[model samples]
Target: MSQQSVIQIALIEDDEIVRLAISQRLQLAGYDVIECADGESALSLIPTGFPGIVISDVRLPDISGLALLPQLLANNPEMPVILMTGHGDINMAVNALRDGAFDFLEKPFDPDKLIETVGCAIEKRQLQLGANKREEYLQQAQGLDQILIGSSPGMVELRQQLVKIANIDTNVIIYGDTGCGKELVADCLHKVSTRSQGNFVALNCAAIPEALFESELFGHEAGAFTGAIKKRIGKLEYADKGTLFLDEIESMPLNMQIKMLRILQEKLIVRVGGNKSIAIDVRVIAAAKESLKDNQGFRQDLFYRLNVAQLYLPPLRERGEDILLLFEHYVNLANIHAKPLSGLDEKTLLAYGWPGNVRELINVATRFGLDASLTVADILVTKPLASIDSSASELSLAMQTQNFERKVIAEALRTHKGSIIEVMDILDLPRRTLNQKMQKYDLHRADYI
Candidate 1:
């Protein structure tokens, strides 16, 4: 509602007597009317700020009101449109709605009903405008959910570096194994930094072919190469005033690396076959799996340039407790997709080392969940229970406990047909106690029968 208590409404009608009657009724209902005799004139007034609502007859001279609806919305989608059609013009009203006309009032409409429809349309328009503004704010904020995962000493130190370096505009080199979430760390820095609102572009140096690497990094003028039919924009230009992520930098061609070094020095790029140099303001985030010190082929000068700052990601095996945290995260994700939840059985968790890191844990958890019948016991049994070496009596105790745990759970599972509640009752234990024991012995009731 505005300071003007009466809402301003535009009416398009060729019939004079009906228009007067409708205008009189609307005026009495606290509305200010701007009347038009044809659709073309009404459409022209749409951009001139005639009124908040448009009430138009379907059939009009010059242009049909139904046909003008789309053009009206293209100019200002917030304006509500109510179409007026005669009894036999139901099809036109339906077409108006499909084309995004807010609402329709069939000719000979009740005055009160028409007023209600306009009010509803106004409310919906306000809601949409608010929602759009909120979304814009969220996009600008770049939200904080992109932080990398880990709790190892290496990871903790890396996070400390991120917090310290986010304010500085410097090149960064990230080192990590494949699937070790190096890119995730890059994203976190970009989002948390002062350049959060700018574009964050990524290119895999290894994935791009050698033949097209030059053209891809730098734009080209029309007729630059044999197949270069048109002028094109490049990633370097697109990432201006933003951040560019160069992944697998170790695999970048030596020739391209040299060109990149020059670009880093000059802060400008010359397109292929184009002499004009375009100045760019961008930050670079380069990543590689190999150590900069060990890789002799990597240009030491280039490494030094990118290494203005560096962050190393620890593999999953090194983050002892963080492995279980990641495991629970995956389980929750699986549940959202209607998959079963699973956790590591004690024996299997303690036995098999996670060589594939956090990525391996997610993969194994996904496999376990998709096969919903798999339980703790099944996971334990599949893993080898080797190396019971100890003092003779201690080794005997270990074997005896493992066998006893297995036998009790196996008999209980058989008798109960794998009903979790029934098994708990037979064992006279709480659900967590049963689950703990099952995990301890690597026992899965689902796999037993």
Candidate 2:
């Protein structure tokens, strides 16, 4: 392979003479070069995954090289960065290496030495990139990492615990906030379990009313009740020799909990209004937003039966950089006509507290994927993306006026970034009137901000 075609180098230095010198050396050494005069220029010039290494001076006209290193690495951590330090800055240079710099060059170093260092960094970069591609390909090919996708420490630990627990045949109770993938974890457990060939049944305990819980869970015999027309198999029976996932277990009424405990203890179930008892050999996985130990109404005995093993799914807020990774994952999965997410979009997503967790993220990703014009801010905002004017003719004049006022105020708030003074100035309204209108429409400045 020709080094000039495969390897690229970015030289960032404020001194034109030094930058030109290094750029020419790398070019003469049969490598491509991107030359920038300062830190800020370097940041914007070096696009994400810049297929090369960086050689920057320790002292820049604007941001310190040390500070800029983190921002650069945030986009591509494996991209090697080298610092050119003055004689007195040797200590700082050593610390940079400890903090992730690939190598450091002292001022007035031999021209040959620069080439030698660049060669070593390029070799390491190639290896790192190759490893990343291999792992990504493997993950695409049905690896465990493919199903549970997140690189945060919390996710890594969750996957480790899940793998260990999947081998065991005991029941598991998953604890997590709503939409944080409790059901996904349960599915993962089922897919890797010894009984993968059998049916995997799922029932939401909360969705079924208290009166219907019995019929939904234990099933009913023909003429079991006024509505029972025929005999049917319950989740436990259908999941025999397989896995049964019960979501929102906390919503189960006390009466049903008692019946569930009995079925669990006996390892069998009897259909409602039926005399025959059917034996069931199955593993049960229960999911709840609240901890069973602290739930005053849940039966401790039943908790023990189901809590033989447990997994805690961390909320997206706590996953750090994993937020961006998941957003990109969903965006790619959608495969629609949408612009690629920018760095500012990543910041906007990371700043907000995701109350709806993964489900909300998936929605935002899908919406953005489908619509080319919507920004991340637009998706995060409470207002509808596109309003319909077809109903304006049917509405009374007063109603239309009110809607128009709300839209004007909302647009001002968004444009001014929730600045009350600016909004009031633009709308020509007194403070009290503006406040009343905001209250009437249930719009808060914090939402726009």
Candidate 3:
């Protein structure tokens, strides 16, 4: 609460004597105050983004503080509201606390208690606001490493490639197997590029119907066709001065493919029923599962135009080094309260062939996180259309324990990227003991790194 810093208090009391007395106490304690006569004025009195605590009397002339409490919170739910109540209103005050009042002061207010409660409210509000700001900044400022969530050589090289061509205006083509995060890569390209401030519009060529694809790409004018009641914006125009990501570009109809090429080459679009030419300055990022280089279904000229910046996303299997890291990340995201993935779970994750790639990995991790009773091995065995070697689950107790020990050591090694010293410290094992365990487990540090 400055001469104009964040406000500290919003006092709404009809009794002038009590209000003045409370205001004097708060001011003496080095706090700010905003006084209101009744709830009506306060409904719009307190400015938006006040960042202050509200202190209101339960009984007001126009509207009770109870009604205004929700209205006050509607703007900023985090705002701490302290209510004042009379002797007989103790029960009502308690109910108000449950209804989201920060705290309540009984009439015949204690000056010391008032100061103390205000101090505590300020501290709590500051902590919450600080945490919100930190998280908001982290989301905007996170780099590719945090967003992509991997450290394998392939991932490292992939990040480098994105950095290399992020600023380039040429159209890009990303090649990857299904669920390999082509769109994620495209998003990364858009986020890090100079055009980051503009929009990043994505369209899955496979998802849209052939008949609607054109209108979806190039928006229509008002009353252009049946059900076209108003003017609409297309993906290309919406993505102006930004990036346009076309996922599964191979699925785009042949006729639409030609228009996509023209949008890329001419940087212009004409609405479905409008004769005006609309210019679009957008970078196209097309993704495909297979090579479009010599495909009969695609136009060679358009393919060449889109293939300017080729980004190949390695399948999850190809980046074996990142399997545990990726799985652990998704698991953490799904289950905030979930314990760490067990040694057996990690072992199962490695042994299975993720037919659906990263997308499948997320579903498996989500299920593993949500169902506390089920392990990765359990989920894998029951999952449809996928096969896994669950032989590790059938081992004798003694053998299973040994296998778990090996799995834990190997998982630690992988997590540390084959750094023996780091793994040793993390596991609290002496060098000789760690080396002996590694030998018994047939685990190679080179393989992990």
For candidate 2, write residues 221-256 as lDDT tens digits: 999889788898888889999999999999999999
**Can you tell me which runs of candidate 3 are displaced by over 4 Å?**
1-142, 386-449
Writing each residue's lDDT as its tens digit, candidate 3 over 41-145 gives: 887877666677889988899988888898888887878898888853657876886788877778776788777777666755664564454344434545787
Please identify model 1 stretches exceeding 4 Å from their true place.
1-146, 336-351, 375-449
Task: Give TM-scores for every candidate, taking all chains together and pairing residue i with residue i.
Answer: 0.54, 0.60, 0.56
Q: Assess each prediction's global lDDT (C-alpha) against the native.
A: 0.71, 0.79, 0.79
Question: Which pairs of residues have clashing backbones in candidate 3?
Answer: none
What lDDT, from 0 to 1, does candidate 2 have? Answer: 0.79
Model 1 RMSD vs true structure: 23.6
Evaluation by TM-score, superior candidate among 1 and 2: 2
Best by TM-score: 2
